[model samples]
Target: MIISVLAAAVAPGAALLAYFYLKDRYAPEPISMVIRMFLAGALVVFPVMVLQRAVVLAFGENPFLFSFVYSAGVEEFFKWFLLYFLIYKHVEFDEPYDGIVYAVAVSLGFATVENVIYSLLDYKSFSQLLFRAFLPVSGHALFGVVMGFYMGKAKFHTGRPLGLLAVSLAFPVFYHGLYDYILIELKRYWIWLIVPLMVFLWARSLWKVNHANSRSPLRAVYSEDEVKLPT
Candidate 1:
C-alpha cells in the first residue's frame, strides 16, 4: 500500500515533467540541472508551508481570500522567486524554451511532494487519487507552462522584460486563484467550471510551447551550422 501510494503521488508530476521536457526541441537542458531545480522546488515547499500556516492563523478561515492570497499568491510567488533568482541568469538558460523546461521542472517537483503528503494524510480512496492527479497535479503543470512562456519571452525578447516578468507571475496567480476559488468557495455545481478552464489552459500552454520552440535562436544557429557542413 505504501509503494502504491508513493507511485500514485509521483505519477502525475513525472508525466508532466516528461511532457514539458519533450517540448524543448532545439536544445534540452542538462538532467543534473533539472534534478537540482526539482529538489530546490521541493525544498521551498517547507518554508511555504510555514508561511501559509502563519497566514491562516492571521486571516482566519475565509476560503475566498485564502485561495487568492495565501494559496495562489504565496505559492506562485515562491516558485517565481526561485526561478528568477536561481535559474534565470544561468548560462544554460540561453534559449527561450529553457525557461519552460526549468519552470515545469520546479513546479512539478513541488506538486509531487505536495501530492505525496496529501495522498498519505488525507486521501481515503482510489477516486480521490484520480481526482488529485488530474486537477491539482496537472493544474500546477499548466501554471508552470504559462509562467514559463512569459519568462521565456522576458529572457529573449528584450523589449519588455519587466512586463513579461510580471505576467509570468501574475497570470498564473490569477488562474490558480480562480481554480481554487471554484472548488473552495463556490462549491457544488461550480466545481464543473474547472473543466472548461482546464481545457483552455491546456490549449494555451501547448500554443506557448510551440511558440517558444519556433522562436528559439538556437534553431537558427543550428541551421547555420548545417549550411556550412561539407555535403
Candidate 2:
C-alpha cells in the first residue's frame, strides 16, 4: 500500500519532468545539474511551509488572503528564488530552453514531495489520487513553465530585462494565487472555473515550450548559415 501510494503520488510529476526533458531539442542540460536543481527545489519546500505557517498564524486563516497571499505568493516566491539565485546563473544554463528544463525539474521535485505527504496522510480513494495527479501536480508544472518562459526570455533579452525578470516571478504568483483562490473560496463551484483555467494553462505552456525550442541559439549555430550574395 505504501509503495502504491508513493507511485501514485509521484507519477504525475515524473511524467511532466519527462515531457519537459524531451522538449530541450537543441542542447540538453546536464543530468547531474538537473538532479541538483530538483533536490534544491525539494529542500526549499520546508522553508516555504514554515513561512506559510507564520503567515497563517498572523493572518488568522482568512481563505481569501490565505490562498492568494500566504499559499500562492509564498510558494511561488520560494520556487522563483531558488531558480533565480541558484540555477539562473549556472554555466549550464546556456540556452533559453534550459530555463524550462531546470524550472520544471524543480517544480516537479516540489510537487512530488507535496503529493507524497498528502497521499500518505490521507489515502481516501482512487478518485482522489487521480484528481490530485491531474490538478495540483499538473498545476505546479504549468506555473513552472510560465515562470521559466519569462526567465528564459530574460536571459537573452537586453532592453527592459529587469521587467521581464519581474514577470518571471509575478506571473506565476498571479496564476497560482488565482488558481488557489478559486478552489479555496469558491468551494463546490470551483470546478467550473478550474476546467477553463487548466485548459488555458496547458495551451499557454505548450506554446511557450514550442517558442523557446524554436528560438534556441544552438539551432542557428548548428545549421549552415545561408547568406545571399548581392546579385
Candidate 3:
C-alpha cells in the first residue's frame, strides 16, 4: 500500500520536478501543457512497449542484443517521436524550456505506469520499493531532462545554433543506449563498468545542458507569428 502511494506521488512529481529544475530561469510550463504531454506519452508508450517486447523475443535472449535493439532502441525512439513530433510543434514549445518540460512529462508518464505496475507486483518491502521508486525511475526523469534540455535548445535555435540541436538528440540516444545496455545485460561480472560510465555521461550531459541553456535567448513566441520548423 505504501509503495503504491509513494510510486503514484513520486512518479508524477518527478516529472514536474524535472520541468522546474531545467526551467530554473524560466516560467513553469502551463498545467494544461503538462497534462497534454503526459496524456500523449501515456497513450504512446503502449505501442512502443509492445514493439520492444516483440523485438526482444525475436532477436534471442542475449542480454546485450536485447538491451541494444529492443529496450534502448524502441524506448528512446518512442520518446523521441513524442517530443520532436507532437509536443515540439505545440505553441507552448516556443521556449527552450518547453523541450525539457514536455520531454520529462513523457518520460514520467512512461515511468509512472512502469512504477505502478512494478510496485503492485514486485517486492513488498519499502526499501525494495524505494530503490525502484527513486533510482531507476528518478534516473529516467533526469535522463529525460538531459535529453529535453537539448531538444528545447535545438528547437529554439532553428537548427543552426552551432549544431547543438544535433548534439542534443545524439547525446540522449547514446547515453540512454549505454544505460540500458548495462542493466539488461547483467550476465557479465564486469558490469560495474556501467556505473562509472553512467555517472560520467550524466555529469557530462548536465554540464552541456547548463552551458547551452545559459545562452538560450529569452524571446517571446506569443506575439511573433508562429514559425514552423520541419520535424
Q: Please tell me which predicted candidate would have the highest TM-score against the true structure.
A: 1
lDDT per residue for candidate 1 within 89-166, as digits (tens), equals 999898888989988988999999999999999979888989999999999999999988889899987585898999
Question: Candidate 1 or 3, higher lDDT?
Answer: 1
Model 2 regions more than 4 Å off: 225-231
Q: How far is candidate 1 from the true structure (C-alpha RMSD, Å)?
A: 1.6
**Index of the highest-lDDT prediction:** 1
At residue 42, give the lDDT of candidate 2: 82
lDDT of residue 96 for candidate 3:
70
lDDT scores in order = 0.90, 0.88, 0.66
Sort by TM-score, best first: 1, 2, 3
CA shift at 142, candidate 1, in angstroms?
0.5
Candidate 2 local lDDT, residue 177: 89
Model 3 lDDT per residue over 105-197, tens place: 887777776766666767577676567655556656666777788787777665475476556556666666677766666657434866677
- lDDT comparing candidate 3 with the true structure: 0.66
30 Cα displacement, candidate 3 (Å): 1.0
- In candidate 2, the residue pairs with backbone N, CA or C atoms under 3 Å apart (3 or more residues apart, or in different chains) clash, namely none
